[model samples]
Target: MPPALNIVPFVSVDHMMRLVLAVGIERFLTELAGFIEEDFRRWSAFDKTPRIASHSPDGVIELMPTSDGTTYGFKYVNGHPKNVRAGRQTVAAFGVLADVGNGYPMLLTEMTILTALRTAATSALAGKYLAPPGARTMALIGNGAQAEFQALAFRALVGVDRLRLYDIDPAATEKCVRNLAGLGFDLRRCASVAAAVEGAEIVTTVTADRQNATILTDNLVGAGLHINGVGGDCPGKTELHPDVLLRCAIFVEYAPQSRIEGEIQQLPPDHPVTELWEVITGRAPGRRDAGQTTLFDSVGFAVEDFSALRYVREKLRTHPFYADLDLLADPDEPRDLFGMLLRAGAGPGRD
Candidate 1:
């Protein structure tokens, strides 16, 4: 007789916390950046799709699904900008990893923190190629839950040592400054977005507002600066002025999706923008001159989530405390999937 089948791993939030604590956030960001860069280098090997979005009156829910040839993954994330006022996280997320061959779920874990980490990692990865060498200072607009992660990622990857923070809500800026007080960064709470962007090498906009507000206007951007636009990821949600995009050499993760959701949405459909992979692969140029402006209009692609899922799966092997769940029913025979359901008496109209 064959041995009993094994149960799949269910990584709870606590299990993920252990993994993150053991690895440390900076190291995880470094590794995640490398994974994302590798995937972008082999961009054609994976199945990609624009995230499926469900818009409600107050917020939006998105499902990002992707797969390499062997592994598959998906993340369910909701963005409710107003939730923070009610003491809830503005973004909450969870994800699953599976084997493409058998379609069996291998792992499941919360992605709220993971999403913050990966978004920062992806931004820093683009900055590595797009920002000027020896870039040190960054202006952070919309200091909220993601501000700390973005600051840390830039500090670790792009050598950002000073951060100028700004938000319409002073409490949000205060919270961000408090979180980074002991993190070895020189933090300055600016009076306005212009003050924050002044003299900064990289400007990162991660606002939570779901409207079309301009955080950075054309007159505010300086030459040779790299812009990480993270807030305007949905239609009617924009952070940069239209002229700012017009003046800069724009780059994005995926073209088709970015054209609709990224800051480039304000530009014409025929407006020329380079894909980040092209710069990574040496197919296109980044920052042509010291005086040229560059923008990375980030919409948080599925491939980045894919990379994050893969990283967590690898980390789970080192820490065994993650719960094991049976999300998929497995039988001794691979072709007897329906048979197992029949044996369990879970057919139509039977509960």
Candidate 2:
């Protein structure tokens, strides 16, 4: 351990899969949601801003940054739904957690999978506070990469044992159904989004189209439908109809950011919406009655990533699914920085 003080821990894709499988996905999502809830409770203690995005006709890439006074974190992620035509994933990502006191990264890990996990966890966490009591069925409108994770998270955290799935592509629906079978889910693969929403207490619109498409129209949403709107996460990309947004009691991660990125972006800037932290912290009302509709306008905020990074770092203590990288400079004398590199060539092992 020559670089014990300078080594950085890296969790590659294989290692992340091992770590997650070792801890069951349900248990992992449950614990991760708990961490998210705890951080949201102390929401005022951290720094947050809208993610910076570079948009394109194909897709978008973003950098989401956030920090508590003691630690800093950020994620580099991209969304290219059309990439599937080339057999590529719609989203790929990685993130870093750094020591604010020293300004060095303590963890660098693959976030493509982690992002799916966190997004599901955060959605279910919001549903816990906003969904109607004893809610069981959820309509998962987009059966892409994220649909399976969202179903499992709702099952684990919000008691959604039944799922009604619909996707524009029946192949995608087949893929979701195939993956979720034997998981104790009462699943229905529907041909239309409207048919999927029938009799379901919750409706989650996760379509990845890059425009203002109406995945959930005004007439489609039921009176008390708890909407987990996760796909409308960019400036030009939105899923809910504007009228649907107006009728629901919208809750957002951060108002300023959500106004630009979340479904609330469809409404005027001055339209009132509540910050979710207030409801989680008991300062605001959630689902005033079973008849009132509620929406969690999630744009995948930086604070949730901060909490996710913290969770992985803690799990690293006993989890050996990490490799060390020599990422820092260390010298016998703090001022003799050049000597370290010079000695490397002069050492016994030098070629």
Top model by TM-score, which number? 2
> For candidate 1, what is the TM-score?
0.93
Model 2 pairs whose backbones collide: none
Predicted structure 1: lDDT: 0.89
The global C-alpha lDDT for each of the candidates, from Candidate 1 onward, is 0.89, 0.91
* Candidate 2 lDDT over residue span 158-220, tens digit each: 999999999999999999999999999999988798899999999998998887889998999
In TM-score terms, candidate 2 sits at 0.96
**Model 1: per-residue Cα lDDT over 67-105, one tens digit each:** 988999999999888897799988899998888997877
Q: Which is the leading candidate under lDDT? A: 2
Q: What are the candidates' C-alpha RMSDs? A: 3.4, 1.5
Query: Backbone collision count in every prediction?
Result: 0, 0
Model 1: colliding residue pairs: none
